[model samples]
Structure formats: C-alpha cells, structure tokens
Target: MKKFLATLTASSMLLLAACGQEGEKSGASTSGGGGGSGDKVIEVWHIETGEREKYFENVATQFEKANPGTDIKLLRIPNDAFKQKLSVAMSGGNPPDVFQSWGGGWLKNFVEQGSVTDITEQVDAAQFHKNAIANTTFDDKVYGVPLGISTNLVFYNKEIFAKYNLEEPKTWDEFVNVIETLKKNDIIPLSLANKTKWPGAYYLMDITSRLAGPELFESAFKRTGRGFDDPAYVEAGKYIQDLVKMDAFNPGFNGLPYDEGGSRQLLYTGQAAMINTTNSFINNIRAEAPEFEEKLGFFPFPSLPGGKGEMTHVPANTGPVFSVSTKAEEPKLAAEFLNLMTTKENAQIYTDTTGSLTAVNDAAPNDETMKPIYDYLATATHMQMPYDQTLPPELAEVHKDTTQALFGLSMTPEEAAKQMEAKAKEMLDK
Candidate 1:
C-alpha cells in the first residue's frame, strides 16, 4: 500500500529511457547514490511509491538543506523487487550508504553478516520504545535504528456494531459468536487482505500469540529451540478454519490485491464489519473515504480462554529499520543524517504521511490513523513481533503459505501446524 524509498533500484530515469532497454536492466536499478560522491552523496533506497514517495523525498531534501555539504541520492523501488536487488548490492560490496530494512528476518541476515553498520553507540536507546529496540537487537547489540513502531488493532465499523447491537468482543468465544451473528445477518465479519501472503500470515500470528501467548510463537519461530507445531499454533489455525467455514471473510479476499481486497475498503463501504490489519489501515480508510472515520472504531484482538496472553496484548514490531553500509565512506555524515532523520519532527512527518507510529518516546501520533496503535502501545501489558518477522525466512514463508491455505480450506489446522514443524526442522537442521 505505502512503500518506502530505500527499496529503490538506484536508477536514473534519463539513463534508463535512452537505452530503449531490451533485456538490459536499464537504469541504476541498484544502490542509493553514485559512488565517489564528488559532492559526498549518501545513497538511500526504499519502496516509497504512490503518493507517499514525495513525502519522504521532501524529508531527504530537508536533510540536505539542513546539513549543507550532504546530499542523498534517493531511489524508490517496487516492493516485490527490493530484497533481491538489495542482496545483489550487499554481496557485491557496494551497498547503499543508508537503506531501508526491518522486519527482523531481512535485517538479521545482514546484521549477522556484518553488511550493516551498528548504530547502537550513536543512537540513544532510551529515546526509543523498548519493544522496538528489542526487535532490532541481535546478540545483545543494537544493529539498526527503528524507523517506526506499530501495534496491531482490530478495526470495526461502528455503524454495523450499533445496527447489530453487538459489543466489541473481549474473548475468543465472544469474537467467534460475533462473527457468526454477523454472518447470519448476511454480513461479512472480517475483511481479510490475504491476496498478499503476509496478510494471511498476519492473522495466524495474531491468533497464535493471543491463543498461546507471545512465548509459543516467539520461541518457536525465533529458534529459541521450541517446537513450531505446538498446541497453540495449531489451535490458532483451527480458529482460522472455523471462521472460514462460517464464510466470515469478505467476498473476493483471495482474488483482490492486498489494498483493494477491501480489507481497508470494506469498513468504509460497510461490506464488512471489521478488518484485521495494521493501524495504517486507519489512514488508508480516511484518505480513501473520509466519512468512514466517523463510523470506525478500534479494539485490541481478544484473547482466547485459558491463555497466557492478555486481551490487550497486540502483535507489534519496529515499524521499519534504517541502516547504513559497513563500507560507507561518509560514516559520520550518515550518522548525522540518521540522527537528523529520526527527530520527533521527521518522525512525525513520516508517521503522519504513512500512518505509522514513531519509535521515539516523545513523538506523539499526529494523525488519527495511528491513534489505535498508540493506545495499545501505551497500555498493552505485552507485545511480540509477528511470527513471520520473528522466524527465519524459510519458516516465515511456510507460515505464510500454510496460513493462506488453511483459510482457503485446503489444509486443516492440525495439518498446517504439523507441516510447519516439518518445515522448521528441515530448515533449522541444516
């Protein structure tokens, strides 16, 4: 939906257009800036496409003006191609001076490989949220600056709830009951953005933690030596299957693109009562349909009975991470850019524009889109990284594919969990 600039291919438009490119991956298509910056350029790459691209581009321009001697070579790429291009750059010893990375699975590989420079000493840990800091830390070392922090919150259509006289669910049974009631009334209970693999996996992660607490998913996925197909993960899968059987998900979920699947639009259109998405959906809805804000409200995902997880506990993680290359020539300038870029002002700009929450303690959410995330982050008793981000790439992708299959009724909950375990073993054993 919203992309950051660090995912770019470092391509210059003029160069690419002239090549009349046939099979030649014309354009810079790599790195953030031109090397040997005659003017000391710091290359920054991300996937800030759509309207938000201009916002961050402005942030870069501001930084350059503030620092005078510094210039940021900004490249914005498509999300699907970012990781592949980033890998090529890092392996070739010409990584961008600063780039966008987060969601632990991606960051960890580079951090472990020493491809990224550690910003711990330069960054004040006290200035950031502990939950975010924890996500970016490895081997007790902080490897990246959390670009933002986010918490999962359930978004419900107030009009639908009032029309049905339904209260926001507080526990698993009530949540299921609510879904059933909505289905019986000929309404979709949930708007799911499963067309993209991550959204389906998002639901699994949400329930697994609430059903089994953060410990199970965290331990299992994070290689804490715990089993992946435990009762908790299985039980969560079953719940997902139960909802699927009731036909609770919005129509066209599997067919629609992530943003278009109506996960963000359903509540706006009253086609679905609620959506399982990040706080960013709040902003998306407002921009897509402003009147929906009056009809929208949010709640933390309810906890299952007899679970260690709190009803208030949410799926949370560092919003995004910013890191620099270990081979950068302008290291101090990069640090200054990082420092200047994360101040409450810049954080506010990015968060306000993207509907993300700042990791910095003093930065208050300026937009209503992030209000729910902020509320949960401030009040939740506990939070955990999503299973996808907590686990290695292979395990995380397994969760993604299996979770989507389970919702599509192609796999039973127990079968999904068992397969997850098999996959985990296969990957971890090596």
Candidate 2:
C-alpha cells in the first residue's frame, strides 16, 4: 500500500507544476493532462469499504497516474450510507461521473430517467464476462461495466465439524438431516436473523429456488400473468417455515441484527457451526482469526430432494457496477476511468486482498470459501440472478417485507403467497 501511494504522491507534484500554465488554458482540472480533452475531470464514486476501500482508492490513483494528463477522483462511501446519499445526489443532477450499482429492475427506473449513461458501445462486450454483462442489459442496451461478482456460500467451521464427525452436506435431504442431527446434539442448527429483513428474503430467494426449481421463479418473476404465490413458491415457503419450526435458527434470530448477531463471529469462535453468506465473509473470517484460513470450508446450496433443477442451480450477480451518468460533464474521461478501475489486474488484486470474487471469467477466486460455488456455476444447468435484481423495485420490496415477516413467524406460506399475488396483479394492472 505504501509503495503504491509513494509513486502517486511523487508524480503529482511534478505533474502539477508543469501543467500550471496548461491547467489555466486547457480548461481541465489538471492543466495539460485530463486525457488531452482539456478541463473536465473524471469523478468516480462507490460504496466499497474496509479492505476493499484500499482496493478502489489504489485503482483510482493508478488510473490517474497511468493516464497522467487525466484527473480522477474516487469517493468511497460506507455501504450503509450510500443508497440514501446516491438518491439525493442523483436527484439534484450532481451524480458522480461513474458509480457502483446493482443490475436490478430498479436500474430500469434510472435508465428511463436518463440518469445513467448507456455504455453499451463504449466498452468491449467481448472483454467482459458474458453472464456478468448479461445481467446489466436493459431493452437490449447495456449501461454499466462489471466491477465485482459474488455467490452465496455455505461456510462451516472445520474444528466444530471434525469434533462432531460431520461430513459437509452435498444434497438437500442430507443438509436437513445434518441440521436435525446437530439439533439433537444441542447445537443451534444455524444462525439467522430475519429482523434485518433482506437477509431473510435473500435466503428464501436462494433456497426456494433450490426446492421449487428455477423455471417457476423465473416464470413468476417474468410476469406471463402469474405471480409469486405460484405453487412452487408456496411449497418453498412452506419448506422455509419447516426449518423455522424445527427451531432451527438461533433463538431470537428473528430479532438479531443480521450482521451484529456476531454471525461471522459465530463461525470464528465455534459458537455456531455454519453461516450462509456471500463469499466476502471469507475475508472477515481471515481478519478475525488468521488460523481460520485453513479451517474455513465452503459448500453450495444443495440440490432439492424431489426438485427437477440440479444442485448446480446457483444465484450469481456482478456484485455491483459503475455507470456513467448522462448529466456528467466528462463522458470520455468517465469511460476511461471505468476502464482503468475494472482492468483485470486491479480486479484480481482487489479480489486477492479482500477475498472477493471478480467478474472476470478468467480471474481465480481469492480463496477456498468461494471455489465450490464458482465450480458449480461453471457447470450449472441453470443459474438465476437473484430475484431482487430480476423483479421490479416495488414488487421486490414486497417480497423483502414478506420474507422478513415469514422469518418472524408472522406470515405463513399461504399468507405470504397471497400478498405476493396481490402485488404482482397490482403491478400488472399497469
């Protein structure tokens, strides 16, 4: 980090003095540089933080240095705070040149409002991963570049598993049996906190697809006049409630803040046996206890007992992306900065340092916790983008709320099913 910074600090001082006269005449933020386009600056914003924060800042600094005539500024916001800030900024017509975004139906609203620059032609489609790129497209036009990608991971503690002589589960029945066995031994089957709402919905999204199969969810989401209460979703929800009834999740898991339940800490301390989380958690584990580097293991969401979809059915997404805004002054510079930030070298570096999965097909996972999920996707007969991304924003929020209520044992499969059906119909009436 220090080495990376030293080179940047040294070059800027000299670049500044030489460009002083040019800076005034050229109209660019940096006199002679700024991509030879003159005064415009490339401003990039994102919510990547912690180990990933350095990763982003390092890339921005390098992009500026590599293309010396250019001035690039990166703002890394805390994730918890980004959504609110981004909304306000974009509404005021002061959106950043490029910023991280998920490829959800919400993006449709952004695209329709002309808030994001369509980069379909600016970037080489062939260079980006096909699956990653596919998710970002709307009405056959692309608007963003891939920054990072991730998959849901089943993380288990090795020492705890070894002590219990537990074999990692490969199938859904096996997984349920293991949970039952663990319960018999007085271990909380797993740590889950539905109070955070989205986590519960995400779990339902990932696992229900495992039980009900992909086509059902896709069909329901695609809106051929059907809705979320489809038989498959109800069955899946029932299965979820079954898990809840087993007293499976930790006591008061419904009340715990998803992240603060010390859920990751649970795996680290052997207090809990497993956590179903994004591969990103691997880095947190490594940071909390270095020895876990060897103890950490991963498994995919298992195949359903009687479902048609193979165990290879996995949920995946380009974690988020940076889109150029139409209101921005520096279109060319924004494109240039986008290219630099997502260069495979930097992408791999960030993945390595933060234990993240990259969006590149050729990039290797930073660690073992993600390998199984990646391997499954490579051969997956079917992979679904998470429903949150696939569904309209209004409908997605309903699912989130319903899933949250379900986990609290307040909404049954039938009731949740009815709520979703009403929502889909309400939206379809448009």
Candidate 3:
C-alpha cells in the first residue's frame, strides 16, 4: 500500500470518525438494482489526503452537479487504517459502494469473497494500459478502474554521484561497488524506512526477480514446480543481509517511518546517496523541496549476471484502482461515477497535480523529471506488482514480517526462506 499521509492530522481523524458513522448508516443499502430511488447516495471510500484528496472531492462535486438527485459521499481514510476498515466493512457485509483498491491479490481476495462488483460490461478496458488493466482483471473479467501507474526504481543524488565519480550501475556487482564506495565515504548508501515493513520487501522482490526471474516467482506463488524456498529467494535474502552487514542503509532504518519523511529527509540533506522507492518520490520531492529537483536522478534496479530476468523487468503496477461493491444499491450508477472519475480531463488533472502517470493511456506527465520514468515504463517487458499486494493478505503480512526480520538481522536468509515456504504451503495447500 502507498502511504499518502505522513501523519494523520486532527481534522483527518475527525473525518475518519465521521466517515465511520456514515458507513454504518449506508452499509445496509450498499448494493441492489439501480434507478429505483428518489435520491441516491454513493458512498465512496479512498485513502487520498492533501491535494489529491482535494482532486477527488472536486470530482465528486462535479459528478453531483452533472447528475442531479445523486449524492456522492466521499470518505477519506488514512492509508494505514484503510485496509482494516475496509476488511471490517467487507466481512460485515457492508462494503462501500466504491472503494480504493490496489487490484491484485488484494482485490482478488475481495472478488473471491463476492465483495467486489464485476464491472466487465461497465468499464471499457481498452481505455487503460494493458498492464494497468491486468491488475483489475480476474478470470478475464474487469472488476475495477485504474487511477494511475507506479514503478519502483533507485533515486540517487546526482551531485553526490558526481562528487564520488560514480555512474549508474548496470550490473549487480557494479551496484554493490557503488554502495560500498558511498558507505566508505561516510554516507548512507541507501535510505530505507522499514518500520512499516513493506519498504524492505521491495529489495527482496526485485533481487529475487533479477536473479531467478518473474516466471519462477509466479510459479512458486502458484505452487507449481517452484516454491518460495528456491535458491533465488534465499540468495535475495542473503543479498539484503549482506547490505545490512555492510552498513549500506542508514542507522535505525528499521525503526524509521517512510511517510514521516524518514528516508526522503536523508536524501534531501545529501546524507543518503540513494533510495529505491516508487515514482511517487518525485511528487514527494516536488511537494517538500522543489529546489532539490535538479539534484535528483533515477535508474532501474541493476541486472544480475547469469540471472534469468532482463533489465527491462521492473517492479511496477497500477496505482490505486477503484472497485464497486457487489452489493451496491446502484451498480450502474456507481460504474458511471467511476467512469466520470477516470475521464481524460480528470486523468490529466491527476497527472498534472500528482506528478505521476495516470492509468489512462492518453494521460501522461508533462514534466521532464517524469520523462525517464515514462520512457522506462514504455519499454518495460515485465511489470511486477509489489509482493505484499501480489500475495494473499495473510501470506503478504508474513512476507513483510520476515523481510523486516532479515533487515534487523533477527533471521538468517535461509531461515527466512524456509519460513516463507512454510507459510506458502500452509496458505496455498489449503
């Protein structure tokens, strides 16, 4: 999941409380046939705050203005609390009419539980990129509309790299050399905030893919010929531990919070030379310190010698997708609202404001800073969703926890691999 809010303000807390009360009142009528009412209320839940929240609110307002007698109730939830709240609502048989989704195993679970609406007939899948559409589709059925696309890569300080006479590394060995050089110079080679656990999982995910390829990971995830205990996974874990042992990351990174400016702050101060984070980091820097924009540089995760994965393989996926509830009182109306949210105009607004790429094929970032990302994504052969979002909820939590354990040196790479394999068997075997 993406952390949009660094810290929940008092007003946000109040909004959550109010939304909770509204959700209780609206849960009973979440789903049914459309057009049988005098006034319609579509309760929409999302984890967008700040300017993005304003954009959603503006869209809702526009929707209401265009469609009289229809009220769009917007619930802005904190990112950390969103999953728990949504899960509670879903399990209680009162999911919101439309809610934010990451649209992979996360959305797949909801579809399996019969909590998500099948929007195959309602949404025009061709309007979005195929990779973005893939995340929202299950069994050839469309269930959600993608809002944007996101990919993770290394963001380095160009000034620092120049000072050390280092260029972007294309191979794993060269990448390691760069990190070692940065560490030797008394700089944090990598800025990481693993207090939330998901940040560190990226390393394992990317390294495993680079070493053994996405096919192996997918096969292991599907419990086919491969398993999580494969050498690729263990090696990935070992790679992370090796970095930890070498003091590659900042001190106390395990306890730091990414949303609270933990890693980005280091980058801003030139104390950390690099951070492997999603493209949203560009928007974050633009928002926090526009002056540092020129100092920023990006590169994809380095390839491994003899590895099955190619350089074009990337850890990427659609940003938050929107799915309607299976039980929505006005499914068609909700679908129409989703359409309104994803219109070309709105998508352009989203791209312009967020400094990110919208899922809409026609909407792209105009900023030069995002051009490299756009270009890289254009040629990406394999876009991998984050492991936490790709795995079932229980398994996802275990992956994150064990990955964190690796960062903390509390578990050996082999032990972590075995632990993941055991969980996979326990979850998938059933």
Q: lDDT score of model 1? A: 0.74
Stretches of candidate 2 off by over 4 Å are: 1-40, 259-261, 366-373
In model 3, which regions exceed 4 Å deviation? 1-38
**Winner by lDDT between candidate 3 and candidate 1:** 3
User: Over the stretch 133-246, how does candidate 2's per-residue lDDT look in tens digits?
Assistant: 777778878888777777776778777778778888988778888788788887776776566565567678776777777777767776675568877678878778888888
Ranking by lDDT: 3, 1, 2
lDDT string for model 3 (360-413, tens) is 988877878887788889898988999898899999999999999999999998
Give the backbone clash total of model 2. Answer: 8
Q: What's the residue-level lDDT of 16 in candidate 2?
A: 88
- Which lDDT value does model 2 have at 72? 62
Q: How much lDDT does each candidate structure score?
A: 0.74, 0.72, 0.87
Give one digit per residue, the lDDT tens place, for model 1 in 1-430: 1344433433455456556543323454433321223377887777644434555567667777776666777777666567778888889786888888764876887887888887777877777788887788887777777877777778899889999999999887889889988988888899887777777777787787777777776577556877777888888888888878778887667756674534766666787888877765654654577678778788888877777777666677675577778888887788777777787777777777766687887777766656656776888767777767767767778888888889888888888989999999887766
Give the CA lDDT, 0 to 100, for residue 67 in model 1: 69
Question: Number of clashing pairs, model 3?
Answer: 7
